[model samples]
Target: MTGPRIALFAEGGDWHAARLGESFAARGAALVRLSLDRAMLATGTETGVELPGFDDGLPDAVLVKTVAAGSFEAITLRLGILHALRDLGVPVWNDARAIERCVDKAATSFHLARAGLPTPATWTTEDREAACRIVARECGQGPLVLKPLFGSQGRGLLLVERPEDLPPPEATGGVHYLQRLVRSPAGLFEDYRLFVVAGRVVAAMARRGATWITNVKQGGEPLPFTPDARMTRLAVAAAGAVGADYCGVDLIRDEAGRALVLEVNSMPAWAGLQSVTPVDIAAAIADGLLAALPQRRQLAAAGG
Candidate 1:
């Protein structure tokens, strides 16, 4: 049996690409790490190289990561590339449209809230005065988490314990997404990143930190944790809400001892989850990708 060829995208993701590749390779699948960032634009040339450094041909699927904002032309060009890949019938992880929504914290929050899933109580306003007022009122004693409309890896998050402590509104387009802070136990300033692949929670683990932030990139430690039925259900629900077959749902316990989703990463990095949990998250991802392939369409069309 030949292995399914996988292409992992973007730069600085070589480690994860390697992890997933190794996981799939161990399972008899050939995984290829293609750093899309290697396709650098030159001073005058157009149509930068594709499939560089390898002669393995286009992949059966690709796991996308890292997107940089650029001028209108660049934005359109990048998006056109994504759409073109999907049009070519290659399976892209996090799915294509899912990437568009999950990258924006504000938009994802709105969509999750609309689906009646539990998310942090949030108020987004370009009106600085209004944003400040809400944070002042709702976050009286507990901390308030101020997030960039587009943030990841727990970066650009502000733990505004006081109203006067927040940055000036003009700093972030005069708008803010303020959520009521939820604190974990004293010993564990941790949260769970529920790994969902193919609408199921493949792995569940907690992160412990000294502060409210608990991302591995933020010096937090990943620890093993079990997913109760509630966590499983909600995590799956959150993924479905975001229209992603693969994602990481960030869950924190609220005052009521219930899990409340804080954020959903459409293109979630599973290095931590893979490390802590016994599940082969990469294989789950590969399985999901294979299941979503166009071959299913052909089989259905032929009445197989």
Candidate 2:
């Protein structure tokens, strides 16, 4: 008998997809690679959503590995496919709503703050004048970090020491997302990346670099580190704040030793974390996704 089929949404030649495929196979499941751009909505089909290679029916579950960069309409359509799948009773790991909240840094910050979580002071606006005022007022305390609202991997970051340092709106995708820069004591550049799965911190690493940006993709070195109880609690809370089934919670400490959440990534990459840890990150994620399957949950509830 064939095992449950899982649809993995990722681009071609993705290393993470390959790892997940292997992990799922080890657990008596088949992982079929699919692209979100190719997912279609058809009225006359058995499943209103027409995913490539799932001609007879929808996959047992959908795992969102990556959502490629595209125009606003294109991205919306891609997310719409995830939404459609969930409405069809197919489990979508980290579903559309969670993706949206984490993709937009402003939204993530809002949710974190609303939950009373300790996060960096942030302000996002489209009005250049208001942004300038925020910069002028906040810069006196320290430098403000200008980040692209819809970006990741430590890209497109700038330290704004003055209002004049603010770029034109056209250069910033028509929005200014600024946060007060949080630095470690004595100019140390380091932060923690905690991998949370099933409401627990399974593994973690310390990213250290010469500059303020400590992302592994940006030349930071990843080192194995066990998270303390406070870090574990903060990371789990950050993930819950954004409603993610699994996530990578970025945490850093201020000079006064208060832990602050830097960001919560819904669709985070774990290659660097995997390299330093022996927890089999990919298998953990596959386990988390499969355990959340609707059929599995129903069976468990029925004592199967």
Candidate 3:
């Protein structure tokens, strides 16, 4: 049962990291678990490989579960190894570019808009006055959401309806990541996370929350979501917009029953989604990336 090797990039403390390793191990695929934080410093990115003590050989596929974005050395070094492994023909889930793009919410929104995907009315600006005006126009007289451009688990998010409600711009480096508060027609404002793997929708769940913030980390509860044709279409389009091989696209239904992409997560958390849906998301990802490698090779072979 020696299947292709798959590496899971996540901190040991994360349960998903352990669960993923266990899942692949049950299938006899060699699983390497490494935390982005533990990777070596920015000694260079050309062929960045090796930390002080970890060397698990180049894996056939890499699943990035968690990233330490702060420490420049940590993020850059891990990205280096992942990118290097990619160049060596090992499929890195999300790849370095996709990961980089999705990790930055601003960039993800930009790409989604460029791809003609329906995204929320978003306004990001350094000028607070202009941003405030946009928010008032869209969200109606304040109570706008100010999310950090680069944050996970709904951290550092602001719901401001007044100037006093607005924190010092310097508090978050003077960058305002604002979005119009869009409410779903459904009384609960349910949001769906469509888990796309191997270029197909594997499983999905609707997150029902009390507020506009529907992040599971922020008390959103998951429910089985059987995507309709429209839901499936939006999920696939959202994934394509960001070029993520495996992704979790957040979608919300507007009044017109139109599904608008809320966000595209490259390294999306699946434990919660899996708990609600009868699907082995991590294993699906591991298997999908493994399958893609050979197809990629065939494509490279056909010169004509």
Candidate 4:
């Protein structure tokens, strides 16, 4: 008998996809690659959905590896497909709702604050004048980090130390997303990325950077680090705040040594985290997804 078939929503043959394929194969499951853009909603079909490679029926589960960047309508259509699969009894890891919360920095911060989780103070506004006023008011105390509301990989970030540093609305995609810059103690540039699976911190690493930005993609060095009790608790709580099945929770400490969550990524890349840890991160995620299948199927059967 054949084992379960899993769908991996991603683009191209990336390194992450390869690792996940090998891990799922080791566990006797077949991982089929599918792009969200190509999936469609066919009402007259047997399954009412036209997902590539699943013509006869739906897969046992789905792992959301990536949601490719697209126009507003295109992205919404892609997410709608994920929502449809979930409503039709297929388990989608980090489902559309979770993805939305994490993709929008403002939403993520709101959820974190609502859950009483510790995160840096943040603000978002579409009005250029309002953003300038905010920068003017806040810069006296400390610098503000301006970021694109819908961006990742530490791209398009600027340090606003003065009101003049605030750019025109056109330069910021018509919305200004700002956060109070978390200053490192004694000019030390460091942060932590903790990988959470099934509500547990499986692996973690300390990213030491040459500048204030500590993302590995921006030349930060990843070093193995075992999180302490407080860090583990905070990371786990941060993931829960956004309702992610699995995530990479970025954390940092203030001068007073209090840990704060920097960001919660619903579909976080783990190559850097994988390099320093021997826990086989991909296998852990696969195991987590497989372990939840029974319970998810039960809920679906019960019309949940």
TM-score-sorted candidate list, best first: 4, 2, 3, 1
Clashes of 3: 1
Q: Rate the local accuracy (lDDT) of all candidates.
A: 0.74, 0.92, 0.76, 0.92
Shift of residue 297 alpha carbon in model 3, Å:
3.7
Model 1 misplaced stretches (Cα beyond 4 Å): 1-4, 26-32, 35-59, 68-73, 185-188, 294-304
lDDT of 3 by residue, 1-304 (tens): 4576776777657877777777777767767777766655344644355543335455666778777656776677777767766666666777888888898888888999998888876777889887766655665543567888887776787787755566777876788887656667856658889999867899999998887778889998888989998888878888888889989998888767788888888988887898987788877876677668777656535631
TM-score for each prediction?
A: 0.82, 0.95, 0.87, 0.98
Better of 3 and 4 by TM-score: 4
Which model scores highest in TM-score? 4
Model 3 CA lDDT for position 145: 75
Off by over 4 Å in 4: none
Q: Ranking by lDDT, best first?
A: 4, 2, 3, 1
lDDT of model number 4: 0.92
List, residue by residue over 83-113, the lDDT tens digit for candidate 2: 8887777778778999999999999999999
Candidate 2 residues lying further than 4 Å off, grouped into runs, are: 294-304
Clashes of 4: 0
lDDT of 2 at 199: 89
**In model 4, how large is the Cα lDDT of residue 118?**
87
